[model samples]
Target: MRIGLYPGTFDPVTHGHLDIIGRATALVDRLVIGVAINRDKGPLFTLEERVEMIESEVAAIADRTGCEIVAHPFENLLIDCANDVGAKLIVRGLRAVADFEYEFQMVGMNRQLDNTIETVFLMAEAEHQAIASKLVKEIARLGGDVSKFVTPAVREALLARVGRA
Candidate 1:
């Protein structure tokens, strides 16, 4: 089976992230959405909350696309998680040139860790090019409507995180 690993903090999965997941799902037999546990960056939502949000969003898409979404929390290296999940490919979303640069470095590092694991980059939908978790949080925190940038679950999660709703 062609299993792919899509790793990210996914603090609150944005529409852009979901878009990439949907597209990547078509190319792989199963996609594991690895939620990286980063001690350096303080997250807005708890790990459980983040997982719930991602699960709900992915579940909705899976209902329509027949894609399987598995959520795993990885504290070790991404390559290790990929190996554990038997993922030969690592899927990444490219939002802009800056994203390409950052993802490129990570891809190179992953290749160094395991030459057998290849990284695949998918561009975000044009409308969601500027949509990111941080930006979504910022907008929602300030009472701006983010209905177009995230799913209903994410929007509610963001509002709850910011103590707005």
Candidate 2:
């Protein structure tokens, strides 16, 4: 069925993320949003919260594109997660050269682990190139407006998380 896996922490799903998720629908019949449970990163949102956010954000896109979107939380290796979801393609969003450099290395390592699964990179739109979840959280923590980077619902969630709401 041409399932694809797009893995991310998604502490708070940003507009940039939604852009990638929406675009990814065109390449696969089902796109599984893998919400990584990286305790080392100390994510702002819990795995359940992240999954809920992804599911809420992608609902419209799924309806519009006629693609089935589901959120799967994983604490294991990304390649293993892909296999669990029956994904032959791993979709990644690239923001800049710096992102590409890291992703390139990941692709090499992932390929060595499973040559059958291919990784596809989608460059973020120019407007979203500068939007990152880390930066967004920082901005919200410092009492800055994040309406430009996230949806209103997400902005509210961020604000509440940072005690701004």
Candidate 3:
């Protein structure tokens, strides 16, 4: 089975992230959404919260995708998680040149860690290209609406995280 791992902090899985997940599903028989644990970045949501958000967001189309979708937390090296999950490809979403540059470096490192697993990049659709988790949180923290960027559940989660909900 062809398995692809889409790894991210997914602090609050935005629409752009979900879009990439949907598209990534089309390229593999199974897509595993790997929620990375990065305490150094001080994510607003807990690991469990992030996993639940991705799970909730993806559930809408999981049944019709022709691909199995599962979200899990990864605490170790990403390549190790990919290997453990039997992922032959590491899926990444690039919003623009900046994203591509960073993702490119990571892809090179991932390849060095395990040459057998390849990295695939997906460009974000124009409408959702500017929506990022960091910006989403900032908007919510400042009492702005993030409904357009995230699912209803994730929007609520973000508000609650900042004691606004």
Candidate 4:
């Protein structure tokens, strides 16, 4: 089967992420959502919470696209995580030029590590392009409405995390 790995911290899965996941499902038989355990970032949500949010959010997409979606938490290198999941494709969502510059370097480094795996970039739709987890969290923490950026469940989670709920 054609398996693709999409790696991200997913502190709180946003609509931008869901848009990418929905689009990615059409390209691969199985899409593994790699929830990165990057302690350096100091994510607001736990790895388990992130995985749970992704799982809850992607269920409808999986059903509609007929693609198997699974969440795999990884603390190791992204390439190693892809290898562990048998993913020949690494899917990335691009929001802007800044994202491209970073992702370009990542692809180059990943190619050096494993030439067999290819990275594919999917541009976020215009409406969702500016929706980032960091910004979303900040907005929620400041008592702003985040319903536009995240699902109701994720919005609630963010609010609860920030003690605004």
What are the Cα lDDT values of the candidates? 0.89, 0.95, 0.90, 0.96
Compare candidates 1 and 4 on TM-score and give the better one.
Answer: 4
TM-score list, all predictions: 0.96, 0.99, 0.96, 0.99
Tens-digit per-residue lDDT, 79-116, candidate 4: 99999999999999999999999999999999999999
What are the per-residue Cα lDDT tens digits for candidate 1 across 1-165? Answer: 999999999978988998999999998888999998886779998888878777878887777778787888888999999999999999999989999998889988988889999999999989999998888888998999999998887788789889999
Which stretches of candidate 4 lie above 4 Å from their native place?
none
Among the numbered candidates, top lDDT falls to 4
Q: Tens digit of lDDT per residue, candidate 2, span 52-119?
A: 88888899999999999999999999999999999999999999999999999999999999999999
Q: Which ten residues in a row have the lowest lDDT in candidate 1?
A: 60-69
Score candidate 4 by TM-score against the native: 0.99
Of the two candidates 2 and 3, the one with more favorable lDDT, higher being better, is 2
In candidate 3, what are the lDDT values of residues 1-165, reduced to their tens digit?
A: 999999999988999998999999889999999999989989988888888888878987678787899997888999999999999899989898999989888888988989999999999999999998999999999999999999888888789989899
Q: Model 1 reaches what TM-score against the true structure?
A: 0.96
The candidate with the higher lDDT, 1 or 3, is: 3
